[model samples]
Target: MYQEITHSFTSKKSLLRTIQNDNIVYYWFSLLFLNKSLRATLSQNKNTALSYKEFIASLYFRFILVFFLALFASAMLFHVFSDIYWAVLLPVIALYLSAQKKGFKAFCNIFEEFINQNFDSDSLQKKTLYQIGEFYGDRYAIHSLVDTLQRNIKTYTYFFGISFVFLVFIYPINTLVTCLGLLTTVLIIRIYFNTFSLLRHLQNNK
Candidate 1:
């Protein structure tokens, strides 16, 4: 009887885990669909009100800022100062590691060298900025790291948090936190899907 009870308990636990994973899959599906839709909506105009280039650029900047703000808010709410400090560490480490990347750093150094040379060009964008952008692009590699970090953070933020909420029904404040956290995750997932759908369309066209 004890063994049977243990078996049943394990089975129930497995079911809950499956449900949680299903929730995550649904979230990704939402992201994929939404991204595609945005692509279509923006590209619909034969002569768009805004240039396509500007549209893309605007989306990029806006999403980046939104991501930054979300990160900021999470850290602030949790009082996780060290967590936010990753922003600083990322850049410094990227710069130091950049030195080993086969002259990429040297190419980038032209920017600093130019500033040191004190050229009489009135415009700052004269030339060094281009080299800087190129070298610095890979310096921190935030873009490359995002997929992994996002996977971990999203799971922790959504699935684990939800699980904890269900388990913590005894706590009063959990009701509020759980609701807010779940709602935020849902919204973010929806936005991600909208853009993802657009990306799919672009890929299909190519």
Candidate 2:
């Protein structure tokens, strides 16, 4: 019975989710500026092109890599501190999730209302608008999640750097130093690819 319960518990938890969650930490540590700016822009742009459902739904994910890269470079140059790290991290993710859910709910409500008011599929504008609304709802949630990840990536990188650096003073730090060098080579390639992907996506959109 105990063995069955244990297996059940483990089976309930997804390894993919665990990996993605781990990745979120890395992304948060890497992308602070993009997180802040993009979230803010979304708020300020109540009537922007991105507000359109189809446009956002189709392109919500195109900017996350850019945001991540922005965060990474910002961290390398600005140097993220350990102070208030936990306080900052949890609230950001929570707030983003709440905001995203609320926005999507509102969009869905509006779309439904419009459809009820004019059950006219023949009108391309009405049909497109409703479709756009549905798309926007999807894209909004995705964009919001990406923003949360972007912020978390920076936070993760900062924390990781601090933890790794701290180990240097406490023990035979030579090993860490060597490891960091090797990791740097790997990170260089990863970062380069990330940048290229962002540029390519952006250019494609343009």
Candidate 3:
């Protein structure tokens, strides 16, 4: 009777664990796919007026999201599966690949739109500094800077919070690596943007 009770308890625990894992998987997929759908919708809206910072933020988010998604799918394919599980993963892999390809194309389209909107010298120059000053007085640049800062803070908070949770629960060593990688990425991006800005400034002077 003791053995029977112990066996029953173990089975119950296993079932609960399976249910919890399923819930987690469901939640993750829902969130990922929902974001993908929303991004797709936004990408289709070519008339959407986004500031330069917002455009950059959208591109950054999409790039990071796609990178992690692809990484997760690859890990599942190569590390998490046994030979027998390949059959189960085949459909998922196909779906993921298809979605990834479509997502990248959508991202490109949105990026192209942003470039056309922001880089067209004729249209951009039409809104001259004098016109901007008349319209927004002296506060335009300050407002833009404040908005960008707030957005950056929110992005940092979200990224750090998620990273912290994963670090504490799953990968403490990887968290350090991720932080270093993130810092490197930020520095590289900053340098790229600074260079781009310098080039634009020179062009405007000419």
Candidate 3 clashes: the total is 0
Worst 10 residues of 1 by lDDT: 1-10
Residue 130's lDDT in candidate 3: 27
Per-residue lDDT of candidate 3, residues 131-157 (tens digit): 322332232222332233345446556
RMSD score of candidate 2 (Å): 14.7
Worst 10 residues of 2 by lDDT: 3-12
Every candidate's lDDT: 0.40, 0.39, 0.40
Off by over 4 Å in 1: 1-46, 49-51, 73-172, 196-206
lDDT of 2 by residue, 1-206 (tens): 11211211121123223323443322221222123334354335444323434223322332443344446556656666435444455655455445444433433333334333434333423333223323433543333334444454565466556555665554435786757754764454344323343334444434
Candidate 3 clashes between residue pairs 3 or more apart in a chain or in different chains: none
What total of clashing residue pairs does each candidate reach?
A: 13, 18, 0
For residue 50, model 3's alpha carbon misses the true position, in angstroms, by: 21
- Candidate 2 structure lDDT: 0.39
Q: Write down the RMSD of candidate 3 (Cα, Å).
A: 23.0
**Winning candidate number (TM-score):** 1
Error of 2 at 205 (Å): 17
